[model samples]
Target: MSKPVYLGKLTLFWCSSCKVPVLDGKCACGQKTEKMTITPPGDIRPAFPYDVNRINEVSRKQFGADMIRPDEIVLYNKAPYEDRMEEIICGGVILGTIRFETEKTEWVLMPRIEGARRICNTKTFTPEKMKSGELKNLIVLNDDAVPYVAEGTSVLVPGIYDVSDNISAEDEVIIITKKGEVVAAGRAKMSSEEMRNEPRGKAAKLRWKGTPADETSPEYRDDAESGFFSAPRTWDDVIAANRNILDTFERRSIDFIRNTAGNMDKRVTCSYSGGKDSLVTLCLTNKALDDFDILFSDTGLEFDETLENVRKVAEIYGKPFRTTSAGNAFWEGWEINGPPSVDNRWCNKMCKLTPITALIEDNYAENGCLTFIGQRKYESLARAKSERVWRSQAVPNQIGAAPIQDWTALHVWLYIFREKLPYNPLYEKGFDRIGCWLCPAASLADFMNLRITHPAYMAGLDEKLRPYAEDKGNPEEWIRYGFWRFGKLPPFMQHIAEAKGIITGNPAADAPAEKTGE
Candidate 1:
């Protein structure tokens, strides 16, 4: 059984003219925009150089060349998957998904029709080139099979007119027409030689189909090259495109902050998390307030970059900075809890909330403080429905307010660029969200990333968790595949783990708890 997917606000619009996402229906270039309906909980972000290079390398593995060009602006929207799956968007269309597979331990690109069309250009690239080993993974389908494959039918051995040698059973392949228009992507059921010699059977199983949702394929009917959707777009262009809207939003947020804080006669402070959202909140707080304090939670797991950003932000603003200590609380709890899972996050409260709440109480003893924190609605379902100003049951006496509640990820990034704020540098390094280096909520993709950037840090964490994992399941597999994240193992996960004998005993029980933040 599979879980139902929750789609958040479908208000994301893209401007083809400027090749950038816009907050409004109209673009600064005076072009009408198209709606980009992406995966749920749409906290989309820009694909920085690190991320783009990763995508290009993955594309090169499956397809012969790079599908993305330097001039284009790409967006990444995280989808609900066991490890990691990011829907990649460019030129106002969701070109495909880039997923991290645990068994393979590599990034794979599952291109949409638009994405396939981008690479399978008949002009510069041809079937002759593939046979000569200059290019690879090409499968030319007979004309009769083209309509069937386009209609979502598997390609049979008899349907294959030509095939490339690089393909083996279960390898990702591009199914194209005799004239070279890509209609579907598939996993080879047999090797290229088997497809050529075998009498009959499925040559490839259709994985993803195209074209009831995108443009009509008349242009590619004659085997022409794709436009590649390449257009130069800098962050400056995005800022300029949304200039009017950014100014409007800044003014509104500042006003809301001033009015909301004025109504409350309590001690004031802005929550600084050293992440992008909090950085933007701090900037807004400075504009709205005459005098306010800055509060930071020094959760022992924080990264060196985060700690540095927190200090720099305080020093730059010349505000009274206060840090609270959790003081070995996480380690003490983890000793009993083992490893916290997505379903059971007891570490959040023990490591962060207790210390933060205690700090708030000690400072504002009489009346609780009104803390302006960075909370965006697009980040999750609970936040989308949450009030702009509210009280946290966990934290006594502190009235919480979100100044950037309605802002999207793009809005935050563009604002950061406009203000020239000294934000954390990790965003450019391919990290979507920054906080604890070993956050339990993080996926295997996030963990694997540490191998290159923080091998020592990951080694230290693996040493601690390996002992705990050996007691519950296959030690190495458990940690490697991120099975420790599932207290109540998801059905799909259980099937995979059980087949491999990774989970030899009962799965861990889920002890539910609310997640404050990363």
Candidate 2:
């Protein structure tokens, strides 16, 4: 499954005439306005459970330790559609974003400027921080070269004053004036030591420059204070505020289920995965239909908690529970497929789709079955544009329907809570979504949480990947860093490996056979 990529927050520009949030400086009435930070009433959810430490680590590594408050709540607002973009909101304002890039890396997208000056940006700190030696990745400009380094201009080697000795080429850096004012945030063209010594060359390629504006304006002050932290304190609070919307959603979904079932000539069943989405679907399905079966594809790689939840939910609903097993299929196919990566997910086919197809064929081959799934548009682009009910070419004899296709993660969570349903314990244990214990699609943050919650599972994964790493001429660190999860190393990982002078070999060459727990 493709993960949601958080691009960043929507830039809020206030129209003075309109007195409301506008997408840009121009209002519908053609009135130009200034940027303002206004905390809008909305849901503030964790990007991931263990993301707090990761966010702090990024802040500390980029700026300095104790720069951002440890107690500050870090939340995310997802972008519309399946773009995989989320705006990182804090204190009721968009601070930055945790973006899942196409390269299989999550990037922090911070604002370039608060108003007229560059105060801070994600991965790049302010010039004051650089002068205080708080920011290690920095390029100090020469005294005579301040005028030339505008918002759009590049920093040249000839005008360089000082550079951090630890700075590497391609590192994100803050270019600052001698007086400690930030000029721009950019990528270093050359290493810090090399840039300082080189007579003539580009030092840093600017991404965003400091704009000329009135920093002392009241708009700027208001913008600074606006943040997402001022939103609802808890999920319950959020749900309570949107109770009417939830009611409408529940009514619509129940109606959809009834209408779809009324039109279908086959038996009704719900595809339950024991995850939040699926659990919601199961609940809605029960509300819509008097009698329906629950079809669960037990991939065998599922967490024990998930398996137990599935049984519990089925028993609670008094529904006929049927399960299909992909027993050891994922492990057996590992030798041929290597490891499942974000780009290559053969495991899903072997463990999920294949078993689901067989289960349908054996049970409902004559008339087929209409399966209500817990698919949401927020999950991916493909699902976003998907029809409310459709037949998949991949899975024959099965018609799929998603009642909560328009719902968001927040909505699903709220509904689950409102219904007083017993959700999977994995979510309480810091898992946002439940799936295979060692799913490669999971973020590094998720993996860290998994390590803390299920050390044995992680250790088992490490053991499995160890031989593959060794066979591929990669160190144990390859498995340790979760490099084995990707079929191809992302640019970020490639940079780290290259900096360490580690040459990674192809795992496809002389691949080892799958071990039978020997």
Give residue 498's lDDT in candidate 1 (0 to 100): 73
Write model 2 residue lDDT over 1-518, tens digit each, in one string.
Answer: 44434322333443444343333455546667566453222223444444556555654565444223444434555553222345555443455444444333344433333211223332234455565767566677887776677647798898888776667776667666654456666678899778867889988887767642322467444433432123224444434445655788899999999999999899999999989899999999898889999999999799999989988988898888888999988888886667776656667778888899999999999999999999987666587678889997878999999998877666677688789988998876756668888887676656766778889998888887788777757676676566666556667667656755445633442243242111
Please list the C-alpha lDDT of all candidates, in the order they appear.
0.80, 0.66
Span of ten consecutive residues with least summed lDDT in model 2? 114-123
Best-performing candidate as measured by TM-score: 1
445-513 in candidate 1: lDDT tens per residue? Answer: 888898778889978877876876677547586766767776777776677687667753223334333
**What would the TM-score be for candidate 2 when compared with the true structure?**
0.69
Candidate 1: where is the Cα deviation over 4 Å? Answer: 1-8, 207-227, 472-475, 504-518
Which RMSD does model 2 reach against the true structure?
A: 7.3
